[model samples]
Target: MNLKNLKGDVLELGTHKGGSTILFAKYLQNINDPRKIYAVDWFKGLPYSDEFGNTDEKKKAKGRLNDTSKEFVESKFKQFNVDDKIIVVDGLFEETLYEKLNDKVFSFVFIDCDLYKSAKFALEYIDNHLEKDGIVFLHDYSNFLNRPKYDWGIIKATDEYVREHKVQFTENPIAHFQKITSI
Candidate 1:
C-alpha cells in the first residue's frame, strides 16, 4: 500500500519493538503530513502462545517474544524524529484499545498481532472508529503456506470477521480489508 496517500490518523495493534511503527511514522513524514499513528501494544509480549499447538514447540514459545519496553520503543520514535507523530497506548488489546483510542477516527489500521482473540478484538474495536472505506491491513493472514501447522488463529479470526460482516478484501501476503458499511 502507498503510505503516502493514507488519510486520517493511523492505528496499529502490535507495536512490538517499534519496527513498523517507525516505518509508518517515516512514511507520514515523507509525505509531510502531521497525522498521528496510535501504536498500541502491551510492550511485553503475547499473553499466551498456546494457540500455536499442544506440542513442545508451542510450549517453548510461551511468554516468548517479550523483549521490549515503553522506554526502548519511545527511543526508536525519537531516533526517527517521529515521536511527535506517534502516541503509545500501553496495555493488552482488551484493556487498552477502546479505552485509549475510541475517541479518534482512523483511515488505516494495521493488525499485526497473530492470535485469534487479539485479531478479533482489534477488528471489532476499530469498527466504529475506522472511517468509511478505510482500509485495514492484516498481517499473518497468508502465512498458511509457510507456517501451515503453526497457530492459524489469525487467519481463522480474520476469515470469520470478514465473512460475518460481509467485508470484502484483497490479499497478496497481507490482507487488506476496506470497510464498506458499519459492522
Candidate 2:
C-alpha cells in the first residue's frame, strides 16, 4: 500500500500486540507522512462469536484471546519509536468507533476484528468516511492456511459489502477492497 498517495489518515481495527499497527506507523514515518494512525481495539481479545455456522464452540468463547492489553501494545509501539504516530483507542467497536473517530476520515482501514458483527459494523461505518480511493484490508478473510479452520465471518462480511457496493474485492492471501468513486 502506497501511503504517500493516500489523502487521509489510517485506521486499524483489532490491533493485537500492535504488530501491524507498528508496521503502518513505521511506513508512515519512513515516508515522512504526517497522517496519524488510529489503532482501535478492545485489547481484551476476541468477543463472543456471532451466530455464524462456521464458528466453533471454542472460537465462540468470549475472551478467548484476551492475553494482550493496551499497555502491552503501547510498549511495543514505544519500543519501535512509532508511538508518536499512533493513537490507541481502547473500547469495543460499538462503543468507540463512532464516538471516538466519527469526525476523522480514513484513506486506509485494516479490519481484523475476527467476527462477523464487528467486521460488518466497521465496513459500514468506515464506508461513509473513507476516501474515494481508500483501501480496506480484511485479515483472515481466507482463514488460516487458506483452509476453513477458523471462522468465515470475514469472508462473508466482505463479500456482502462488495456485492452491495459493487466495489472490487481481491483476495491475495488477505482481502483488499478499494472504494470506487463510481461503479
Candidate 3:
C-alpha cells in the first residue's frame, strides 16, 4: 500500500483527540499530495474508557457530546505533526455526512464512531461514498474484554451489517477491519 497515488478524499467517522487521523494525515503530509480528509464527530469525549467499559451509558453520552472544536483536534494533530494535510468536519454521521459530503467519492474511509447507530451510519455512508476498490478501516471488529468498551457501539453494528451484506473483511491486530468493496 504505497498510497502515493491514493490522493482522494478520506473520511474519519470518529476522532477522539484525532489519534488515528493524525496517522493518516501525517502520512499524507509526508507524501505531500493533494487530498481531502474529513473527521466526522462532535468530539465531546468518549462514552467509555478503560475504566468505564462499554456498559456505561454515560460514556456513550460523552461520545455523543464530546467537547469538540476543529482547532482543538487539529492542534492535537499538529502536536503529532500533521497539520497541513487534514480537514475537520464536525457533526453527526447520519445527519450531517451525506448532507455535506455526498458529492465526493472517497478512496479510504476509517470508521470509529464508537456507537452502534453511528457506526452503522458511518459504514453505510462509506459504502455509498467510496469508490470501487476503496478501502475502509473500521476500528473494533469484535474485541471482547471483561471491562466495558464504548467503541462497540458502532463496530458491532458494522460487523453485523458487513457479515449480513457479505462484504469481504480482513482484520488487523491493531483492531482495524479492512474492507475491500465497490460502492
Candidate 4:
C-alpha cells in the first residue's frame, strides 16, 4: 500500500514481547495517525503438533515465548507512550479473531504468526476485512525463499492464500498485498 495513503486502524497478528508492535506504534506516532493498533497474540506462547513431523510436545507444553508476559508487553507500550493507542488481545487467533473482533476493519495488517494454519487464517480473515487499498505485511515469508534454516509453513500458507484468491503480492522487506480489486 502507499505509505502516503495509509488510513484507518492497524492490526498485528503475532505480538511476541511487543518488539515489532513498538515499531508499528512509533510509525503511527511519526505519521500522527490517531487510529488504534490492535495487537493480537497468544502471550501464553505457541503450540506445536506432529503435522510437520517435527513435533515438540515439550516445547508446546512449556509454551515457546512464554518468557514474556502481557503485562510486560503493555509496559513496553507504555514506556513508548503508545499504550493509549493500542488494544492488546491475548489469545489464540482462531479462538479470538472473529469472536472478539469480527466487527472491526483494518487499513493495514502485520502478520507474524509463525505457523501455517495460523498464517492462513490471518490472511483469509484480513482478505475479508481489509478495506479497499488496504495493505498486509506478512513477516517470515522470506524464510521460504532466502532463509534456508527456517521452516516453510508460513511460505506455504501465504503461497496458497495468494494463489487461491488471485491476490497480487510483493516480497522483500516482507510479503505485501494491497487490496485493489476482487479476483
Q: Which candidate is the best by TM-score?
A: 2
Candidate 2: give the clashing pairs: none
Stretch of 10 with least lDDT, candidate 3: 45-54
Better TM-score candidate (1, 2): 2
Error of 3 at 119 (Å): 0.4
| C-alpha lDDT (0 to 100) for residue 81 of candidate 4 | 92
**Model 4: ten consecutive residues of lowest lDDT:** 50-59
Which stretches of model 1 miss by more than 4 angstroms?
1-7, 50-61, 143-151
Model 2 per-residue lDDT tens digits across residues 40-106: 9998878766555274763475676788999899999999999999999999989998898988889
lDDT of 3 by residue, 101-125 (tens): 8887887888776666666667777
Residue lDDT tens for model 1, 118-182: 78788888778887678899886665456553344677777778888755687665578888785
Which segments of candidate 4 are over 4 A away from where they belong? 3-6, 50-62, 143-149
Model 1 / residue 111 / CA error / Å: 0.4
Q: What is the lDDT of residue 53 in candidate 3?
A: 26
Question: Mind sharing the TM-score for model 3?
Answer: 0.75
lDDT of each: 0.79, 0.82, 0.66, 0.77
Candidate 1 worst ten-residue window by lDDT: 143-152
* Regions more than 4 Å wrong, model 2: 1-3, 53-59, 143-150
